[model samples]
Target: MNLNTFIQKKINKQLIFPFIILAIVSGIFFMSIGFRTTITTSKIELEKAVEKWNNTFTNMENFLEFLSYDNNLIDNTEKLGEILKNFYNKFQNKISYIYFSTSSKNILIYPETDMINGINPNTRPWFINASKNKEKTQITEPYVDHITKDIIITISKYVNGMNISGVIGIDINPSFLNDILSNKDLLLISKNNIILFSENKNKIGKTFNIPTKSERFISKNILLITKEAKGNVYIVTYKNLFLELLPYYFISLVSIFLILFLGKIVNKNINTELKNSIAMPLETLVNEAKNYLNNQTFDSSKITSNIKEIEVLINEIADMISIIEANFQELKATNEELLDAYNEIEKYSGELESTYELFIEKMSNIVEGFDENTGNHIKRVQILSEFLAKKLGLPKTLVRQIYLYSPLHDIGKIKVPPEILTKPGPLSEKEWKIMKNHTIWGAEILDGDPRLEIAKKIALYHHEKYNGKGYPFGLKGELIPIEAQIVNIVDVYDALRSKRPYKKALSHEKAMEIILKGDNRTSPNDFNPKILEIFKKYEEEIKILWDNLNDNK
Candidate 1:
C-alpha cells in the first residue's frame, strides 16, 4: 500500500479509541458532579434536622416550666406520666414518647398510641444519665423501648428551680431525618458510644467499632463533628457507589480490556503496512541521494520519487543553495552592523541602572537624615512587616510592597516638633493628641506619591484598634487594611522593645503575654480576635526577629 493510503486508513481507525475514552471520562465527570450535589443537599437536610430537634426541645422546655408550677415538683413521676401522655396525643406522629428522669433516676414514662409504656425504665442507660448529669440537656441515640420495642431518640435536661431536682427527658423518632440524609449511609453515634440513629438500619443502636480501612480516613472527621463546637462542621467523604452507576463502572472496565486486546491486533497490521510503504521508500531515497553525491555529477533530473511533496522540495532546495553562494559576501557585511547596534543598547541599559541607584541613595539620605537609627528602624520594620504578611498567607506581591514601603512608617513623625520627638516624660493629653496625628501627617506626606500609597495607608491606620477605639479614623476589623493590621503588631513589638525616655524596655516574653491576653478589646474597641490569634501563632519567630534586629543595632 502507498504510505498516504495506509496513513489515511490508520487515522480513520484511531477515531474509535478517542470516542470511547471521551465517553468514559465524561461519565466519570458527570458522576462526580452528581455525587457532590447529593452531598450538599444532604448537608442542608442534616442542618434542618438539627434545627427541628432544637425547636422541639424548646417547646417541651416551655411546657416543663408551666407544668412545674402546679404539678408536684417533689413527686413528679405520676404527674409527668400524665403530661407526657398529653404530649403524645398533641404531636401525634411527630413525637413517639416523653420520658422524664434525673441522671440516675427515672421520674416518668409516657408512650405513643402505637407503643406500650407498661414497665418503668428507671434503671435504663438514658434514664440514669438524665437523672444525674447536670449538663443542660443530653440527647440520646435511637433505641428500642423494652416493652413497646419501637426505635426513638431521647433528650434530657437537668432541673434547677429548687435543689438539684434531677433531669427531664424527651424521646423523638428519627424516621423524619432518614429522608434528608439519603445521599450517604449515615450513622449518628451518641456520646456513650451507642449508635443513636442510622440510615443503615443494620447499624442502629449498635456499638460502633472502627472498621480497619476507615480508621485513617473517617475517624478524625467523626471525632471533630461529635464535639459540636460552634461553627465546627466536618466532611468525612470517601469512595462510594450509587445503585445506578454500579453497572457503568463494570461495563467500562470490560470495554477497556476488550479495546486493549483489539489495539494490539490493529498495531501489528499498521506496522506491517509501514515497512512496505514508508520505511522502504525513505531508505530507497537516502541510498539514491548518497550515490549521486559520491559520483560528483548531481543532476536533478536523475532524482524522481513517487512522493510528490518530497520530490518538489528536493528540486527547489538544490536551486536555493546556488543562489545562497552567490550572495554570501554581501550578507556578511550587514551582520557586522547589526552586532554593533546590539552592543550600544547594552551600554545604554547599564547607564540607566547606575542612575537609578544614585537616585535611591540620595532619597534615603534626605528621608532619614537626623538619626542613623531611622534607617535601621525602617529596614527592620519592613522585614518584620514582610514576615508578618507572609505568615498570614498574603499574596507574594502584597508582601513585597509591605517590605518596600515600611520605611515611610515614621515619615509623619518628621512633622512632629523635635522637642516632642525626644521628650523624656509622658505627654499631656494635648501633646498625646499631637503625637497621634503623626499617622495622619505621614499619610498626607505619602498620599500623592503613587509609590507610597499602600505604605501611607499602613502608617495612617496601623495604630487603629480592632474595636473602633483607634485614632485618626476608627476603622475596625477587616475594614482596617490587612497591611495596617500587620504593621500595627510589628510597631507595638518594636516600641515595647526599644528604650524609650519614659519606660524601660519590656521583655519579649512579657510583651507576648500582654498582646496574647486578647484582653485588648472586642466589643468596646480593639484588635481583631482572629487577627490576634494569627499573630500569636508566630510569636516564637517574631521574638527571634526582634532579638536579631536589636543585636544588629
Candidate 2:
C-alpha cells in the first residue's frame, strides 16, 4: 500500500483505541486532581487569612496602649486635647480624630469638642462589639467610614479597666494590608476555586489557565498539602507555588509511551506486508490451476501483471492442468466401455426375475385347471389374502410378500403321483396321510435360496392350523406366524370354492360361515378366528375378486 493508505489503516486500527483510552483516563485524572487541589488551596488560604486578621488586631491593640498610658498624655479632657493636637501636627494629613465617652449616657464627652476632637461613639459597630464581649481592645470588620469614604478597620479599648471607658479608634486604609499580601504572591480564590482576585487584579475572577505541561503543578500541591496537615489546624509554607515543574516531567513520560506504542504498530505492519508478498504468488498460481482443470480458458497476457513470480507460477499450473484434461478424455472413453458391460448384466438379471414370474403363473393355471369348477383358484386366493391382510391392518410388506408367494402353495403337488392328484373318489386314510406331506415337500423345494427365504416361509406354513391341528408339524396358536395364519384362511376359502374331483365348490356364504363358526378361537382350530372375521366383512369384495380371476383365466 501507499504511505497514506498504510498510515490511514494504522490510525484506524491502532490510534482510535488508545486515543479514546487516553481521553477518558486523562479527563478523570485531571478532574480528580482539580477538585482536590481547589479544596486544599482554599483551606490554606482561609487559614492564612484568619491568622493575618488576628495578628493585625493585636498590633493595633498595642498601639492603643501607648496613647492611653505610655505617653502619659490623654488622662482626662485637657490632656486628651493636647495629645490630639500634637498627634495632628506629627502625623500631618493622614491623622483624623480621637474620642472619649461615658459608660452609658452620651451627655458628657471627653475634651468636650464637636467636629475636630471627641464626638458621639454610640452609633459605631465597634462600640457595640467591645461592650458585649468586654474586650480590652478590639477591631471590627472592614467597613466604609462616613467621612473618609474609605474601607478601614476600627480598634477600641475599655476605659478605667471597667464598663465606662472612652474609645480610642483609628481607621487603617485597606490598601496597606492589600499591598503587604500581594508581595507574598498569595492567590485569592473564590469558593469554587476559580481565581477570584490575584496579585494581578486585571485577571480577577477568571479561570486559572495552566498549560497542559503545567497541569501536574496543581496535582502535586494537593498531595503535598494533604500530607502535611497534622490535625484540623496546620501550616505549610508556599509548597503549591513551587510545584510547577511536575507537568513538564509528565509530558516527557507521555512522549516515551507514544514512541514505543507507534514503533510496535509500524513493525507489525511491515512484517505483515513482507509475509503477504511471499505468499500471494503461490495463491494466484493455485487459483489459475483450479480454473484450467475445470476446462476454463483464459488469456496468458491477462496473467502478466507486475508480479513476475506469480505470472510464471500461473503459467506452469495452467500447463499442468491442460495435461490433466487430456488424460481425462482417455479416462472418459474407458468409463463408457465399462458402463455398456454393466447395462448388459442388468438386462439379464431382469429377464431372470420375469422368467420366475412366468413359471409361477403357468403352474398356477395348471393347478387351478385340475379343479375345473373354480377357475384360477390360486390367483383368487392371492387377491383375497391381500384384501383381508389389508383390512386387518397387517404391515404392507408382509401382505405383499404373502400375496406374491401364495400361488406356490400347490407347487409340491408336482411330486404327487397323477393318479392320487386326480382321484375321483375320497382319499383313503393312508393316501390322505401321504397327501399331507406335500406341505413338507413344498418347504423342501424352497429351502436354501437366500432371496426367496421370506416367501418360502409363507409357502411351507400356509397349511398350518392356528389350533395346531391342520399341519405336518401341528404348530399351535402364535407359534404359527401371522403370515401363515393369513394364507391358511385364504387357502381354505379357495379350496371350498373350487370344484374338486372329490367335492363340489361351496357358495361364498357357506364357505364364510364355515371359516367364522364356533370354537375357531380354541386350540386345533383350522384357521384364525380374527382373520376369518376380517374375511367375512369383505365377503362381497372377495367374491368379486374370485369371479374376476375366473373370468381372466
Best by TM-score: 2
List, in order, the clash count of every candidate structure.
Answer: 17, 3
RMSD values for the candidates in order, in angstroms, are 17.1, 33.8
Per-residue lDDT over 285-336 for candidate 1, one digit per residue giving the tens place of the 0 to 100 score = 5555565557634456544556677577667756665666567777887888
Candidate 2's residue-wise lDDT over 308-398, tens digit each?
6766766776577657757888989999988998999999999997898778777767755543345667777778777887888989887
lDDT of each: 0.62, 0.59
Q: Give the distance in Å from residue 250's predicted Cα in candidate 1 to where it truly belongs.
A: 7.9
Model 1 C-alpha RMSD to native = 17.1
Strongest candidate by lDDT: 1
